[model samples]
Each structure stands twice: as C-alpha cells, then as structure tokens.
Target: MPLVSPDNSATSSDEIMRYPFDTMRTVAATILSNVSIALSEHEIAWKKAQDYVQSLPDPLQPAFMDVLNKHQQRIRDSYKWQEDFAGALFNAIDTVSNTDSNISTSFQKIDNAKFTGFGHGHLIVADE
Candidate 1:
C-alpha cells in the first residue's frame, strides 16, 4: 500500500498516521473555545448565587454561609485535585515531541489558569 498527497508528493505512512494531530488540535481548540464561553457564564451564575446568599436575613445568614462554605471548600478541593491531575497529564504529553511544543505549552497555561481561576471562585461577588 502507498500513501499519496494531494500535491502528488509521496508521503510516509507515519505522516499519514500523524495527520490526525492537526484535526485533534482543531477539535480541541473549538471545544476549549466553547468551554471558555461556558466558564464566563459560570462566573455570572456564581455571582448571582453569592448575591442570593448575601440577601438572606441576618439570622439566616450564618446558616447559609456555613452551607456555602462547606460546599465551596469541597468544590475547591476537587478542582485542586483535578488541576494536579491535568498538570501530570500535560507533563506526560510534553515528552512526546519538541515539534509544536508551543501547542502543549499553550494548553498547559490555559488549563492552569482556568483551574486556578475557577477553584478560587474568583467570579463570586465580594463580601462587604
């Protein structure tokens, strides 16, 4: 069997196998873009949640804050774990090749930034 390029250039089977890398990048970028938009929406929702929590009656505020604190801490812990896991994955992938390593670097930066941003609940309304 032989592999042929559109330009009538002979291509290696390995090159053909690696062609999907570009496709994977395109797919990943599109997915990440969508996720980024969703994250923005998540931030809005968190702000609303914080506002609602803050609007509670003075006596109820303590209870509400307690619940929110517990849940938020759990969420942050889970995200921290996931961030570590993702960092490990990125490190493993980094060993693959130096070619287009920038792509991996970009992903690592985005992953860390997003994880840390969300983990800190930076979108939530500030307490007075």
Candidate 2:
C-alpha cells in the first residue's frame, strides 16, 4: 500500500501540529496490513506443507504431520501476537490523539475565557 502525502496547501497550523499523530496512525495501520499479508502467505505455505505431509507413505505421514502441526501452531501463535501488538499500537495512537485534542481544546477555551472582577470583595468570576 502507498503512503498518502498530506496536502499542506490547505492545512491549517493545527493540522500541521497534528501531522505526527496522523503519521503514527498511518504507520500502525501499515504494520497491521503487513502482518495480515504475512499471515496469508504463511497460511498458503502451511496448506502446501500439510498436503505434502499427507502424501507421504502411511508410516512417515503421522510423524511428519505431527511436526508440521506443532510448528504451524507456533507460527500461528507468533502471528497472533504480532496482530495483537499492532492493534494495541493503533489503540495507543488513538488515545494519544484524543488526549492531544482535549488539551488543545482546553487551551483554546482558556485563551478565550473572559475573567471579570466582582464587587468590593475582590472576587473574580469567568464570563462564559
């Protein structure tokens, strides 16, 4: 898959600041895509191996199949781990993005808030 380039001409400063988050999200998605492709390839190879093992003479078939099955399970487990890791990475990026957005919104609110002085007691109140 091709990575998409950001269109800077139409992007605001806020969007520019968020570029890193976008990049991270894209990278995480790409990692997941790669892991899926690898899993597909592994599955194809596994089927071929199984077919080959099954074609072996009766006495040898069981032993070879046993080994293949064990190794296949391990390989599948490894791929599952990779897929899980990628998913976690994507979630982390989303969390960070949300946090950043919240922070930015908070700052904007603070910047726009109007503080007013109350009567002789010298109390202050924010005028929303």
Candidate 3:
C-alpha cells in the first residue's frame, strides 16, 4: 500500500498545496479493473474445470461435481462480498474527490492573495 501523504514536505508551499486526487482515482480504478480481470480469468478457469470433471470416469464424476459445486458457491459468495465492498469504496472515493475539490478551490483563493504581515514595533518592560 502507498502512503497517501503529500509528496513534498510541508515547507514546500507549492507542492504541499497540490492534492493527489487524480493519482488516487487512477490507483483505485486500476485496482478495480484488475479485480474485474481476475474475476473473468477465474470464470474461464472454472469452466475448464467443469469440462475436466465431466470427462472423469463414471465413479469419480459425482465426487468431482460435488467439489466443483461447493467451490463455485464460494466464488459466488466472494463475488457478492467484493461487489458490495467495491461499491462502497467507489462511493467513498467520489465523496473524497468532491470534498478535495472544494478545499482546493478555497486554498487557491488564499494562495492568490497578496499580503504581508510584520511586527511594526516592540516595547520593553523591566522587572525591578
């Protein structure tokens, strides 16, 4: 997992001011795409396994089918679980993106302002 902090130190105003929303979105999308590809590959492999089980000798076919059926059930359950998880994750990403956009807009306004501050004068008091 990658640490999500700013790439530059806090002292670097330019870099610190920039948000990595795009990078985060890309990473999340890439992960989801990979999961999709993996699910597709799993389906293909399962189909092959079914074919193999069908070709097994008569006495062994029943046992293989039972095992395959159980395995498929587990895959189905996992798919459902991940589907819900991905949905929630995507929603969270969207929420974060929206919030980040709002914050960045406000930051830009502050960044664009021209102002200066200083202590005009100082008075000293002595203790007796």
RMSD per model, one decimal: 21.4, 7.6, 10.2
User: lDDT, candidate 3, residue 53?
Assistant: 86
Among the numbered candidates, top lDDT falls to 2
Model 1, residue 51: what's the lDDT?
A: 91
Candidate 3, position 34, lDDT: 69
The Cα error of candidate 2 at residue 105, in Å, is: 1.8
- Identify the runs in model 1 with alpha carbons over 4 angstroms from their true place: 1-41, 96-128
Q: lDDT of each model, Cα atoms only?
A: 0.57, 0.78, 0.71
Cα lDDT tens digits for candidate 2, 11-128: 5544334336677677778878888999999989989998888888999998998888999899888888878887887888778768888999988977787758667886465866
**Residue lDDT tens for model 1, 13-115:** 4343233444444555555565556556756776787899789888987898788777766765655565555455444444444545777796666655534
Q: Each model's TM-score?
A: 0.42, 0.66, 0.53
In each prediction, how many residue pairs overlap at the backbone (N, C-alpha, C within less than 3 A)? Answer: 0, 0, 0
TM-score of 1: 0.42
Candidate 3: the clashing residue pairs are none
State the TM-score for model 2.
0.66
